[model samples]
Target: NCGTWFLGRLQTERDVARVLDGLEGAASAAGNALDRSEIGTLLAGLRSRVFLMNNAHEEGHLLFHTRWAMSYLRGPLTRKQIKLLSPSAPEASGDAPKPAKSAVPTSKSSRPVVPAGIEEVFFSSEPGTYRPYLAADVTLHYLRASHGLDSWEKHVILAPLEEEAPWASAELLDRGDVDFSDDAPGVAEFVAPPAGSVGTARFRSYGKQIRTHLYQARPMSLWRCKSLKLQSKPGESKSEFASRVQLAAREERDAGVEKLRARFAKRIQSMEERRRRAEARVDREKSQYEQQKLQTGISMGATVLGAIFGRGGFGRATTAARGAGRVAREREDVQRAEEELRDIEEAIQALEIEVEEEARAYLAEREDKAAELEEVVVRPRKSDIAVMGLKLAWKPD
Candidate 1:
């Protein structure tokens, strides 16, 4: 019977061999392409990792985790080497998925949603490693505090922290809920389980799966994102009174500019009419003078006899008086036209200057905030697990 122990150990070694075969294939399948010698090194590294389990469990696998697990097992966290966790290198065949689109930030902070709306607003933050930008920051600073991530972790995601809903039957889960504790599930518990362990002791270990799902919070993409909020009345949460006010202000200002332009046009038209009337009177006076010259073609001797009589010679004098009056009126009309044109031109120049000055002032206000806006992006970041997105956690009223 003692000699038959070889048969039992033979089956165990066979299982071990099967696991190695799978690991080898997976390691080579990556685009990085692990060689046979590299596969041997990978196995060695996996075996050498220290398992920090409690007294309850020790059912370990030869390759229970992905490639990232090896990196996690290795020591001190470095911010420079942070990246999204991926099992394989990006494929050259275009099968690999692209990273989600991120919101492009510019030198402006108070961004216009469409130059007339508001969604997210950003300020500034202290520089350094944080969240999505710093992948290892979560593992090293958060997960490594106890090295507690498990192979089969649970997720119960909900909406971000906000006002309590009208029909919420329960309070929103807090950080204290999923926070790592002795009672909370950990990778160590998976390594070892307490006696009287029910179905898969690791999964049931102090309800870690349930707890992880409870406090799940979706991280924000922006390093410095602030919610754009409006002041509300006692009973109204969705009212957009503030935005309405903003829209009204823009309409009024634009309308005023149009009114000024109309007034300027009318003044110029009146000056043009006065100039035309003066030109018409000047033409009539010139015609009368020409008719007088034709009638007086008779002679100077006849003119001398008429001059003594004082009636015939006075006809030429009357034409001259009327021409002089017409000339004077035309000169006044010309001066009026020039003055009106100058007034219109000055008004246009002033309007142009006002627009430029206003633009300069607005840009100056954003100048102080530019340094922070350039470094970060603010895209819509919701929990990937929450497919429908953060819904009304409580039953709708």
Candidate 2:
């Protein structure tokens, strides 16, 4: 009886073996060869992963495997590796069926239905005015000390927040919402939720996510990006910082002109190289065309000689002359094609040269500007000034 106790474990092992056998059968049917040892390894791997579950509600054993688990057991899969015969693992083939698309309701009369597991919350600073929007799992990060729920009203423009909405059940008392001044510490603080109101206080964690989303969604045009660099101090105005930043950026840009000039020079050189190659190719084709024309002329000379000799050769000679003339014409046509190619290439070169010269001039101007900037902005050392003063003192003046 004691020896038979180990037999119970065989059932679990057998179940795992059966699953492997099914996989092996499928592989065989598909003409995929699998060795017996590999099948045994697969079974053993699945069995080894099994764990017993014990709880107050129930007690049983469960088997679980994952991408990481399979990778750990069988080593990493590489492009070079091929599966001769394999088990039906999700990762082996990305052929899992996708969920069907849900149909959107067409009728305007349909009530707004929030998705399952999502919640719609409304909060307002003013009485009788509430705004509603959907959020997914708002409390997910609330347990942590540094995390809390963020009021959606801050970032999201709720329908009620708009200037007009006739159907809105809630109305805010104050129409004059404060606008945060630019170059200021807190434009958002004016719109801040009334103190002790649910709209004001937020869970730090959710608030961080909401703020991140708002910042990301904000219009990110080049002008907006440049305008975003406000003064570090709260008291400083945004316009003041904006002007300083603009001037500094202009100065930096002026200094970078030398690099731009080098870029233009390199581009011009590359364009010239390409032009040469295209011209050479066109020349080679033209030479082939000339050879063809010469061959045709030689044929015509023989035909003319045959015609002068008379007898049975006259008719053939005339036909041959006509063919030769056509060939020469075609050769001329080839020459014309080459000329067109040359013209096109020259046009391209002219355009490229124009572009390069313009770019060079632009860069040179910027470089000159930069040189001026260096002279004006980069102050000379005190030692140099002192030396200059001594030289002046020693002079006749």
User: Model 1, which residues run further than 4 Å from truth?
Assistant: 1-222, 225-311, 370-397
Which is the leading candidate under TM-score?
2
Local distance difference test, per candidate? 0.32, 0.37
Model 2 agreement with the true structure over 16-106: per-residue lDDT tens digits: 4565465456555555554434333223322322322212122212233223334345776765564644535656446857775332312
* Model 1 superposed RMSD (Cα): 27.0
lDDT per residue (tens digit) for residues 94-149 in model 1: 77578852323221112111111111111113222111000000110112111121
Off by over 4 Å in 2: 1-281, 371-397
Pick out the ten consecutive residues of candidate 2 with the lowest summed lDDT.
Answer: 388-397
* Model 1 lDDT, full chain set: 0.32
For model 1, name the residue pairs that clash.
56-192, 56-193, 56-194, 57-191, 57-192, 57-193, 58-191, 58-192, 156-213
